[model samples]
Target: MSNQKTSDILISEVGPRDRLQSVSTTMPTAHKKQWIRDLAAAGLREIEVGSFVSHKLLPQMADTGEIVAFARTLPGVFVTALAPNLHGAQDAFQAGVQKITIPVSVSEPHSLANVNKTHAQMFEQVRQIIACRNAHYPAVLVEAGLSTVFGCTIQGVVEEDDVLRMAHTMAELGVDEVGLADTVGYATPLQVHRLFTRLKHDLGELAGSAHFHNTRGQGLANVLTALDAGVTTFDASLGGIGGCPYAPGASGNIVTEDLVYLLESMGLRTGVSIEKLLVARETLKQGLPNEPLYGFIPDAGVGKNFHYAGEKA
Candidate 1:
């Protein structure tokens, strides 16, 4: 089979959106641009460049359009953005983002609080957005990411059946894929394995990309569980610069450096350089002067004896 015919892991770097949103100090736009360029140059094929939410709402993402345009200049990279509503989607589409992921919370309380819409209203909105994107920007792929699929801080446990129903609903509404997010970082390896297995059986090809956060220190464990359950695509932040604004000291999403190192050590191909990934952390410091970044790889220093398997670019 051709390489194109084979399925491989698609790691969508979400540090710009997920990680940046929680921090108070807005990152420098130039530093953001250079960090994105460096990541793309280092071989990440897809990156979530920004979110189309209001500048008033998320000051960290005020330069979304500009960053999206800059990301487009790089070759062989799929530039993506998060569109919180139809207006955001339109802005992202105009910015030439090839893909837009619109988040819809599985937990109704989270949905109402985060986006000011109920689950039914959000699903209907996704339907309209899908129609709009299909008619106007046919090249763009819309993924309805069901956030808090595992558990919610405000809403307690989200039922697995509810998640599958949302996935099916999004698929029926014509979304390209349905992504599961472990918002608030409450997912464990057992839950990840069982939930992914259940979603695979129910959602089929539409189920993908386990989004994990290291809030409770189960990030890499959940990642491994998802891999065992046959999930390939993953959403991780660079430098582990993520946390819930409401939940303090919850800094970290499965660090891209650690994930790459784990994959390489297991003889899997991630196509990312561990050293370059660590070097990229310098941009984190520059972009976020006061922000404290977290990750074991940077703290542990990749062990004394280690070598990256990916071909250096």
Candidate 2:
């Protein structure tokens, strides 16, 4: 079964959308465009360019449409965005995002705080969004993300049944896939293994990507669990720049650099060049000057004995 699973890993870059939304200062559109371009040049096939939230609240994502337009020009790169509702989905479709991800928290308190909607209400929103996408953008993939699947900062201890139901609900609503997210970064490896295994049992082909946070230092461990359960796609941020700003210290996603290094050393093909990924981190630091980046691989540097694919040892 492991051999039958995907031999190549798909790293879906989320820095432009997630990282910028977290920082105290807003990144300029030109910088964000260059960041996106540099990441694509580093061989990231899929990227979550931006979110379609209110500019009044998230000024950083105000240029989501423009970023999406710019990302589309890069051949072989699939542009993705986060849309909370039908309106966002419409905007995403107009901007030509190839995929749209909508997050619905399992914890009611988290859900209300994040989107001001209940899980049920959010499910309806996803359904409506899916309908609209099917009518106008049939090729566009709709990803329903179940946030706070393990625990929540606001409510705490989300039930596994809620996650299963959310996955089933989204799949029933015509979503292309359903993802599990560690929004507050409280997932353990055991929990990761259990949830994803159970979720796959319930959701089948609808089991989507893994969106883990490095809040409590268990980000990569959670990814390992997901891999053991047959997950091939992952969401990561360059330099680990983006995470739940509300949850301090939980400031990075699983670093794209580190995850790639882990996968590469373990014999999985990620199709990313570590040198290019590291070079792109410079653009990240430049974009968010005051933001402190996190990643062990970047600090430690690649070992002398390390050999990436297509590179001689």
Candidate 3:
């Protein structure tokens, strides 16, 4: 945990990739860099800068390599990117990312719909990614981003046993971590608690970040449950900007600013500056003024006499 505050929670900013990909208007590469820089300045230690997928599928992330290089120049920032297969993972590692996240959906239907791969094929890809990473850049961490661990939009009611089985399989395959994602916002607090608790029990330190969508407005509530279940790392977006393109009902991710407020107000340090986070939100606005951004903390302003327990801005 040398890269993070031991006493504080780690918030991984995913807006640059997750948010931009869902929109039609490609965010300017320069604007993306500016937004990422501002986010790092706001005290976010980890950020998923972009995804290393095909340009045909996601033109917005065409410049992920350049973005990764730019993000590396920032001090104290750990840059991560999404890689759907071995090729993407190799490209991401060669581009100099600190970590790579390869998503594998627990629900077979969702996996096929999202990545055009079955569970077996996706697991094989993960194995290849791990082998490639080990052979080339052993320092680069490879994480299994378990998507649709909750119920899936395409195939509803994903079983808990499937989630656990896949998580254990990822752990057995030598993934550095396994993150649970609520791909369609079908997860409840009790469900989140039960699932994450079981995952932690199964994988221990390998059970990683919690990613939730606010489609039903339960994103923050789910985060609370994950925290109680002993999850420290969380994946959130700037101004609440994210949703799965493959999942119809999926909507925005848990808003980073409000999540930080929730953690800091409870005296759990997040090492983020709420005031500076709002400034970063403004940077996002200026870059993509037409896009709608969501967050309550920015609208209501900081509470009267609010004191941040983390590092001061």
Model number with the top lDDT: 3
RMSD per candidate (Å) reads 2.8, 2.7, 1.6
lDDT of 3 by residue, 151-182 (tens): 98788888999899999999999999999999
How well does model 3 score by local distance difference test? 0.90
2 versus 3: better lDDT goes to:
3
lDDT of each: 0.82, 0.85, 0.90
Residue 243 local lDDT, model 2: 69
Candidate 1 per-residue lDDT over residues 1-313, each given as its tens digit: 0011122566788998888998788888999999998887667788999899988888989999999999999987888899988889989999999989998888898888888898778877887888889889998988888888888888888998888888888888898878888878889899899989988898788786788998888998998899999888888888886765543344578888888877766656767777777777887778887877777787887775566554342
lDDT for position 118 in model 1: 88
Scored by TM-score, the top model is 3
Residue pairs of candidate 2 with colliding backbone atoms: none
lDDT tens per residue, model 2, 1-313: 0121233788888888888888779889999888888898888888899999989888989999999999999877888999988888899999998889988778888778788887778878987898898788898888888888988877877888878887887788888888888888889999999999998888788888899998889999999989999898899999886765444345668899999999888778888888898888998888888889889998998898888755566
Superposition error at 242 for model 2 (Å): 1.6
Clashes of 2: 0
- Give per-residue lDDT, candidate 1, residue 20: 90
lDDT of 1 at 100: 91
- Which has the higher lDDT value, candidate number 1 or candidate number 2? 2
TM-score of each: 0.93, 0.95, 0.97
